[model samples]
Target: MGIKVNLDEMLHQRRMTLTELSGRVGISLTNLSILKNGRSKGIRFSTLSSICSELDCEPGDILARDHSSLEGED
Candidate 1:
């Protein structure tokens, strides 16, 4: 496990669609889709800022620590 994106849940809680978020965030649907699905390798702070602003949430709300993998590291 790694950093898990919580975009799906946040979108659902806001009753907003990906399409709508894309428009508001000025990000392409394809890119947003990738991020939303947790398939993105990374995200720029500007993009993240836009998303957080539009969604009315913080980065912590959209990203969560996946501690399961840490247990085996040591």
Candidate 2:
């Protein structure tokens, strides 16, 4: 995928556990794991907002684009 989820790194910087984030964000661990592992096809804005609020970060902090992969795209 061209978009990478930097959840693990953000969590590490915040010293937060997935379980704790799940509770704070009112999301399930399974769903959070899918996101953390980069297995998610997409994410809801509300969900992203909640995560950002709890983690004290922006969407850029959690997600990044692989410019190299887009180099050949029109």
The C-alpha TM-scores of every prediction are: 0.88, 0.88
- Encode model 1's per-residue lDDT on 1-74: one tens digit a residue: 58889999999999999999999988999999999887888999999999999989999999997776665542
Those runs of model 2 whose alpha carbons end farther than 4 Å from true positions after fitting are 68-74
Best by lDDT: 2
lDDT of 2 by residue, 1-74 (tens): 28889999999999999999999999999999999998898999999999999999999999998665665543
Each model's lDDT:
0.90, 0.93
User: Cα lDDT of model 1 overall?
Assistant: 0.90
TM for candidate 2 is 0.88
